[model samples]
Target: MKTIEIQIEDYITNDKDLISVIKRVIKDKKKILLQAPMGTGKSSLILDYLSKEFNILMAIPNTAQIETIEKRNGIFCLYGDKQQKGYRSETTVVSTPDRLLQATECFKTKNIDCLIVDESHELYTTANYRPKFKNIMTLQSTLKNTSILHMSATPQANLTCLKGFYDIFIKIDSKKKLKTSIDIYDMELNPSNIKNIINKYKTNNNNTFIYFDDKSMNEELAEELNLINVNADNKKNNEILSEIKAKNKINENIIFTSVIRAGIDILNEKNAVLIICAKSNLTTDDTIQLIGRFRNNLSKTVIIKNFKNEDTEKNNQSYEQILNQKKKYLKSINDDIKRWEENKIKYTKEDCTEIKKKLTELIEIFIELNEKGEKIEENHRYKINTHRVEISAYSQLQKNKTKNIDNMIKLLEKTEAIKIENIEKKDLNKKANKSFNKKIQEKSTEKRELKNKELKQRIEYLSNNLSTLQLELFMEGSTLKTLEMTLEKGQREDRELRDALRKTLSVVEPKSKYYKTIQQIKKYITNDIRDAFKYITQRELSTCKKDIIQEQIIRNNISWIKDKNVEIATDIIKNKIIFIRHFKILQILDNYGLIKNSSRISKKILKKIEDILIKEKYFDGIKKKNYQKIIMQDLELIFNLSRNNKEIRISSIKTKNMNIENKKQTA
Candidate 1:
């Protein structure tokens, strides 16, 4: 083991206990606890003592003060910041517990000589400590000797209960006398009260630091002091830091800051007034920390707090009105109970116990949920979070109570002995009133009138769109050109020819098979609607091998060269993938236009084909129907997007839901 001399000449005075304990702890290698009130310069004394020989990593609670704390402590140390990524090489690292926990894996301090945890009371704040504690404790494995020095004015109870955590306790005395005065006020928590507090107490302008527990109200507080140039565009932290660093000793700078509490230290705040938002049961350590900004005896703290009323009325009603409603409800319930007792309702012991047991179980389940809720709500009183959990434990409890009452009533009515005629008669009498009968009659007439008006409007809308949607009941007598001029007209179509699918390519399976020949023919088309618009030409049909007819109507058919990218003629000849009711030559001509190479193509004809394909639900829809789905005057239009759909374009309709599975729209 190597020994080094500790030196801090004339740096610390009067606090002999602080100096003695540090020396003893380093010499003996034992865990020690230190408690020193704020403004005592305890941090400065220790940093100077350890900087000469040992590398110190000071765990700061306030991340905003990383630069200030390092400078005030008189130690040039690295902190957890974006620019300081190379912190691994730094001899002294100073940052908050949360920051250190994130970068713990980068630290290679084999047996740390000393670990100082600042704001040591946070060691047990479950939210503050849980994640960071796991990483901070890793120092125990890295430490060569000496103990972890936990420092705070008031150590939390959880850490103090741990056995063998600290061997010796040290309390440092501040040479400067403590002088602070606090004033409590029960002013309402509103903008008016805040303005008054600022006007009455803001002495020597902008020297006072204001803090609010609620973050949502912080913006409003800043607005109230907007004239001080504080409501600038700068962020809350940057604005406050610049104001504190300004040369003027706090005057006429409207800086609304939410900080100034906790482990933050402000050296320039001496003789400055402290306006705090405090609560009941204030601790001595907390008061010292809050007012510790000024080391001078002249500085004072004024607490302006208002008592919170959790049970305040929610509506614009008098107290008497609320009381009357509560009384009426209770009286009605009491009357029902009295009547039940008078009626002498009978029930088996087992049945009654079962009902009681079920009710108890419901109550226990609600209690369990509420217990979990409380654990989630556990947070620092000052740093509370805002959230909206729609259901409250009280509301849920009330609902459960109502359900239990209804269940009990139903069970009583079911029992043969418990005749509930008295309760039923009273409820029936309220419904049998003359005014109730008149109200029901009027409502029924209004509903019938509304329904009739809707039906008439629907009939008129359908009649208007009927000409646009032409339907054919019998295809044999249709006058459409495509159906009448087809070559399959004069010939008996061979029903059973060996129709074999030569090649197979399965990308996605359909949920239902629409065709028996191609068991699951799920087609995915990506080309433009106009590309597949080409019907077989008369000349091309003369040399065609076969035709595929759909629903006794002849659909187009054409031969397709299987592969387009063939280096040799043999490969091109071998791969012949033919599509039916779809002309490959027409699709090729349409796709060729996309390459910007063909100028001789007839665009007018291509557009006509494209319009026809759109009517078949090939592309997206608009307010207008696909013109191709319409003949000159005999268009059989299925207004819906799906193939073979029943929805006609004649009526005003609504899609309940359009579910898509693998890009297939299912309405």
Candidate 2:
């Protein structure tokens, strides 16, 4: 293989030399593999420069990339059920590998000068996990006559398969210095560590992006931090991206999984990247790809968790051994076919024909396996050749463990590309504790403010409803005296006013009408005074009880108790047997057959059973009689045990009776 290395700066400034190299390779009808660092303008070179001279058909790893390319370059991109007829009229057409493979018949008739495979590493890395890789294999063979250019930031595919296909390998190195600083933590990736990192970065008003492989963890951490999460399971990914791009990016932090690891650019500056690496999920290549998502050349910080790799040596098999295993499997399938043919009475002719057809396909695959060293395995009744690719890729990922990451960091440090920091376990814990304490203090302040607001509203209500005299007496802190004085004053005033009115109106209208009006006024005054006194007293009492409860909650360190209703709390505290801790005691009684039926067992026998359970540590502090009563009651409730005159007996009916009663009530 002919290898060439080019500086990215030179390629950007004067790309004539590299273009000449590619042109020569194309003239010779050879395949080329282009390796370059991400964010170094690999796509720009192809779409802007190469498309002008050559008819390019770019095969991306996914449809999302096609959309991104089309939006950026204003080129025609095809995927899904879109027609390929327009592909022939465009200078540069972008489509996914699967779609490209399906349109191979169309491509064979068109004048495609160069076929570019973007993110080509996925061809092997994700071959086993994704079904599209099968189509990729067919596309590779179908376009054997066309000039192919494979491009990736991390080309981790097995080169043995591409040895005969690709003749030239070009690696482009960036001349611009990396301004990102990476902090490596020698700890497990957990909620505590994630919280600590987010807080540290957010304190400086910097945006942060967290890359974790687990979808559930991504959603959980995003929710816990009150940030946006992007993953395959998220339905509003496009909307989330739009939100990130919109003005006022208040919640700037984001948590994403592997779905958008590549073929996406977050054009934000001063962003902090956090990669959560586990033994089973992320590898060195994945870490590199994650860091490449940030395009701006501003100073950034990256935090990663460093952990050891698991031993996968047992899974590694030699090529010859794999072939031998396949041979044995083939022999077994043949033997089954032979037996079916001999027993035609039991097996139909159609079954025999299907088996023979499958056998022929397996034999053809077996020959290809031997020729190209492709791995094969049976899925249901069909055989697939994608297994070896998965094994090879996994082994490569596993082999590059903690040491590989350390080496990559050391290389950057040696080149003066980044500043490296090691965060110790103690420091992480200290930060986590500080964050936890801050949250608690904030919650306490919030609750105090709510209580103060409630008290102010109550005071406003009282001031609005209370009379001048009553409010004055209440403010003087004399509750009983205020009620009494207000009542006496109302009675005295009422008597005087009624006397004056009667004397003034003595000669007017019927006296009975005036008497009814006077009685009504007296009754209204008396009732108003009484109701105000009652409202004031109850409000004061309720406020006092709330204060007492809040104080008790703080003193006992059971603040959660304040949220529960009084009735519910009382019920829970009074029911000693309904606790989950007593479940084991019930099981023990059941095991001893003592929970079934008992003629009120002698007090002595009950005590003996209690002693045995207590000795076995089942009953912590329960007494004998209480324990016996609890057991009997539970047995009756759950198993429908019957009690007749102080004698308990197991009823034939069980949980079915309770279920029937529940159904009847629901009906």
Candidate 3:
């Protein structure tokens, strides 16, 4: 065992808030979520707080963060020989998520007392839970005493979406003074733009960080700069520090890095210029994190988007990928639900009701959290080391239907199409309905008006909650969602069958053989499905035709893209049934233009995409919902369905083959 030591200064000793919170969490042994602003010395504070007792395992995103941590700790603790890897007692072991997951393959339990996940927001933002998430979850379950801490620079930037699952929360307040005015410019990122930025900002004494999501883009841009380019891989700690600290440089030195905000932070006060290229497949949070690196500096941030001409940008454009995936997700669950039902997989109404209740409760908590923001600290019981502490944060946004009253009110007011009020309103002077009549019903002017207002608000709340419930019904990524999808798929498929039968009947006479088959199929549908499709082929003939066309579009649209020229297929899509197929976004633009020419996509396009995927007329995003609110639900639903579908298919296929072999042997 060796002693763990770190450099402590007067500023660190004086700052009681950071040290107190860390000590309190450590003492209580509760899982904490540490959130501090940029350039606040979070790593330094953490190092200062821990002594010889706590064995720490820190999972980070980039190796640059590892370098930074090593420099602060004055030693590295990688997963190899402890002595050889420069590991001492209470040394913080750091590695990227993928690497840590790989190294801990034979792990039954974690010996480390605390596990801290840096950039914790990535877990929620990703499409599904990666191997690292699974490993951590297992670690949580296996190591009963392991204190799992999820830390992020959430407040003033974004909320940690995964906060609901944890037991503790801590938000640190650090003030950053603007010594130099930050000038921000938004445009496309390209070679010409890069050259212009370099020519303009590359002064002799200035230090610049050109951030990129893509490694190739970072390398290419660095090459384009034609300067002394250095990154995390090509430098020593002292050398890099000296290079950065060199105040009298004749020419500007640059370090173009992909690892800007994902743990690699430099505590430097040189004239800093940030060229943040927000022009990549990276999410909005990622872009914000990158740009936030220069938040503490007298820095100028140039946000050059990854823009291209209309033709070139069309291929890699980010649109409604989730909504399209949601439909596929639903269809995938259909077979599994069917198989589960056959296999007698027990599910009860009571179970569903209980789950729904819990989900609703979580959602409401989140809604209140997002609305309340920092204000709700007084309302809720939060203990952070004897201080009334609150960080820039969002509420516990659980992946369920949470009610936001203001947002709900805005929605109800905007849409006259669907009145949210459930009450049957009579005239102010007229007799009240017996349903609304009370035992001692006496209506005064003020009382009546107040009652009416209360009723309206109640109705709006009901409407909002109902919409959330319905949308979230199939969106939560669990067996519950799969079951919901399976239950709804019957109706969805029935509608299609009805439309198919109707279309066939309309085109064919009573004497036609195909008409009889269609009639028979209708009978089968009626007998098999719950009387939902009894009169399907008769009234919904046009709807059936539209469904037929939509299904065809979904099926053939892919082959058309692969084999045929897209422009020539105008005749195939002449009926304007592109939006009908929720799975595919047709190039056929309306007044809003379904696809925008601008680098940053318009909100209208997003709405169109939502409507095409989820019901636009529905609560999913009709009232201007954020992506996290909508997409998390969709992701959860899709993940469960996709996972269950694969399992069921594999199981059924294996069983069928075994039965076939048995029958062949007997024969």
lDDT of each: 0.39, 0.52, 0.41
Per-residue alpha-carbon lDDT of candidate 1 for residues 1-667, written as tens digits (9 for 90 to 100):
1222322222233446547658667667766666655545556665656655565666766665666765565544445454554545445567676566443433464434567777665554322223344345566446666467777655532233333566766644443334554444544445455555655657553466565444434454554465332322344546544655432244332333334453444544455565555433233334445555544432445554443423323322333343343333323323332332333345334333322222222122112123223312112111111111111212222222222323323432332211123212101111223553354446555665664465334333322322222211011122333322332422213221101000000101121121111211111112321111111121122112122112111211111112222112322111111121133333333345421232342445445555655544333323444332222112121112124223222222122321122135333
Which number leads on lDDT?
A: 2
**What's the count of clashing pairs in each model shown?**
9, 0, 6
**Candidate 3 minimal-lDDT segment of 10 residues:** 386-395
What is the per-residue lDDT of model 3 for residues 18-132, given as tens digits with 9 covering 90 to 100? 5665666666667766665545566655565653456666676655556656665664434322233422343456766655644443233436667777667655544222434
- Candidate 3, residue 532: Cα displacement in angstroms equals 50
Provide the global lDDT of candidate 3 against the true structure.
0.41
* lDDT at position 356, candidate 1: 29
Q: How close is candidate 2 to the true structure, as a TM-score?
A: 0.52
lDDT string, candidate 2, 94-139, tens digits: 7776676544444545567788888887765651345555565665
> Could you estimate the TM-score for every candidate?
0.41, 0.52, 0.41
Better of 2 and 3 by lDDT: 2
The model with the greater TM-score, 2 or 3, is 2
Give the lDDT of residue 519 in candidate 2. Answer: 26
